[model samples]
Target: MIRAAAKNHKDVLVVVDSQDYPRLLEFLQGNQDDQEFRMMLAWKAFQHSGLYDCAVSEWLWKQPTVGGEYPLSFAVPLSLKSSLRYGENPHQTAAVYVDKRLSEVNAGGIASAIQHHGKEMSFNNYLDADAAWNCVRDFNNPTCVIVKHTNPCGVASRDDIIEAYRLAVKADPVSAFLGYTASTIVDPVGGVGGIWLIWDPTQVSVSAHIANSQLIQATVKRENFKEWVLAAVYASPNPGIRQNLWNDLENTSSLMVRPWLIAGTILPIS
Candidate 1:
């Protein structure tokens, strides 16, 4: 019937067989001669058949049981919401989706995050943010988490937000450079190397002096000086982490403030 329709120059063909539907569609979609596509179709068919066989076996196994003991079946539905800017790297494509079942029960997952500012997030950002957010969320006290490559390089919990951040950074200052910090408060002081700060901006405030002084006397006294002082701030709903503390110096100059937020959590107020 399909060949007959094609012989007659039909514009489209509708295939109804579950077993051949995917392959037919793939063939019509210009993958007719692709070996990879053929292999993928075969694998998918095998998986589908295997699942059906498993279901039948499960049913048969339950039929012989006297006490009606059977394995429970579970299904999770997911919906794609948007595509990420990129995967771990720029060459890879990525997307974000939400589990319908889980989203109903939990309110704090990545799918619920709100971006206040900044450029589109990458796959690594979501991964790193999730790691940092989960770590800080587990701590009740003011905490700071500096994540480098999906691992926490520095983490500290303290009553003082600034002190917690300092202690976290002090844990592994070198690794903390260009790392992501998740905490309840963050300060945008200079001297501390580049870092991505993520926290709840509503719970933090900038000091008048520290906010005014971008470069302080202590930063100048440092032997190894970097041209750029601080990196970006992300305002999230998670706990806030503090930034570096600026020394009270008469000759300190005010820092240029940039307002940016990493989507989901962590934000810097200008």
Candidate 2:
């Protein structure tokens, strides 16, 4: 109506009753060029034809059931866990929350993952890690699953962790760089360019214990700390230096570590 009035270069008048007059007046405030017509045409028509009363009576008769009759009409209980570093992108803000009922039944999922190493986990990292972890956990043998944008790009199972990794990478070599790997063992010597590591600490128990001590010492000795942007620890470390390791890494490195505790086990990785 406003556009038509502007195009025709003429004033437009709107007719409304007392009930709708205020709203119409507010809408046409700056645009009004003529006086408004006030009339209760609708009310007079309904009074004579009884259309409004019949419609109201029909609506009341067909009213839907509520509360007790429809148990699905209930609110879910949720508790805010923590704020994520950012959402899928840096400009957006996001947070993690847990459903009270679901968390009680499945307590070992991503909602309980701790940050033990790099920067705070981003929303995308949590999603990718969750996907990779779920796939790797399903296999009994040594398995490697690489996830990118919440989809598995490469997945393979073998007796040997290294062979499994190689086979997984062979699935899609090009996408391997832009993905996060969930595996029993990740070769640290491999190019760490775009590949993010989500390693199981239990798989490298012996070496992880030694690496824990070495990592602390390396942090102390090296003047330049390398940043592993996408690396996450999804398994618990040795109990002896758990606190010490977390403190040292927090103090020394620019990298973020996510310490996950699953089924009463603390998974610490750097």
Candidate 3:
């Protein structure tokens, strides 16, 4: 109706119920002319087109509703969990939500993943699954990725998923069991309260140790993080000291370090 009025180069009056007139008037307000009317019509048309295309089309894998709220329906109620990391930084909050109906239907009525069992999910768990599950989906062989925050602490692929899980867990066992295993300094003994282990049934362990674990997150995504292992550590020494040492090393590129420097290096020393 708005388009028709705009095309005729006339004032567009959208008359609905008296109660809706206030809402309608809120949509259009400006010093008016045919040009302005046409522009308004075009903008409205574009928005409507985008809504139908992105929000209502068959290609929409995820749905976004008005006011950013996904309505809960009997057919598709959502299950949610809060994440450990805030947004992209240490302070920003985040969470994950899945449609319980779709999950149950797709997984053959098996509620294999129970998020309420123990520890809450974290941003890194979602991120880790984003990296690991895709890898699990791609190959007949099993694969695993230990992620610290969004980066891979350790990743490996093996015929047996359990072996892969062992390799992933061993990468930085002290940190691996914690939420941000590779990035955070987890208490060596105390913080092992809950560790989320996401895996297929073949890789699932039933031992008391595995049962005592805090959380085990499991999912399937294509193209896993089996080969993208981050180095053991990402810390850098003082830049000035490092640069000077680098310059000295470059000048004596072939020089071998004495036993003292090597011996002085901490292994047993902190």
Candidate 4:
């Protein structure tokens, strides 16, 4: 009716907000050409209608047949989580909504995540990140799950979480770089390029530890800084210290390379 009156070039008075009662009375007295006031009311009317329609649709979706999927009359009310910059595409306006009950106690899910850094997450990012989180959480060991378009591109669980991540990235490097990655265990021993060396501190001791803006290296040793096995590498993105990082890696590799064999009783973790 509001659009029809506007199209017909007639004076239209839309009432969607009770606060506008004063304005409506003023317009009734002598202001009929109040296009701005009418337009504002029209906008509110449309937004309210859209939300009501969404609620009705959700309620109807819950209705089930005698033996069909949906069960009975009920409502599934969702509260907004956030307004996204864009939805599945730029053309659509979108917001993420969550079930408040689930979100309240969600300790580690994406819905309850507190981002430490990075640009605003998109709708698709939430979907893919949630997928990666779900998959990675299922494993007890160190695991990496890479999800693209809400599907797993790479997933690996290993005795070594770093090795698991390496295998996952090797499984599909291009996709791994583009998609969301969720890792269950990241070795606290930091290294270069956001990389980490994951090791069992109970089985070995740290002989020497090294860290630069670009990398971190730790020499794994026997009982008390004795002979060792191998060195772990993590490279940072800082190009300012490339030469220093390379020299350190080379020196460590050349000086620490040694052949070691292991033969031991194996007990598997469930």
Candidate 1 per-residue lDDT, tens place, 1-270, comes to: 443433333343433347677667667677346545444544544444555566666656567553256456533335577788778765689988875556567764766577888657778888988889888889999999988888998999999999999899889967775333432222223222223333323433222222221221111112253322322332322222223322222123344333311222233443
Error of 2 at 88 (Å): 2.2
Quote each prediction's TM-score.
Answer: 0.40, 0.37, 0.31, 0.39
**Local distance difference test, each candidate:** 0.53, 0.53, 0.43, 0.61
Model 1 worst lDDT run, 10 consecutive residues: 213-222
Question: On a 0 to 1 TM-score scale, where does candidate 2 land against the true structure?
Answer: 0.37
In model 3, what is the error at residue 200, expressed in angstroms? 27
For TM-score, candidate 3 versus 4, the one ahead is 4
Task: Mark the regions of model 2 whose C-alpha exceeds 4 Å error after superposition.
Answer: 1-71, 100-108, 137-140, 178-270
Ranking by lDDT: 4, 1, 2, 3
Winner of 1 and 3 under TM-score? 1
**What ranking of all candidate models by TM-score puts the best one first?**
1, 4, 2, 3
Model 1 vs. true fold: TM: 0.40
lDDT of 2 by residue, 20-68 (tens): 6676567567664433221233333334334345555545545675224
Clashes of each: 21, 18, 16, 9
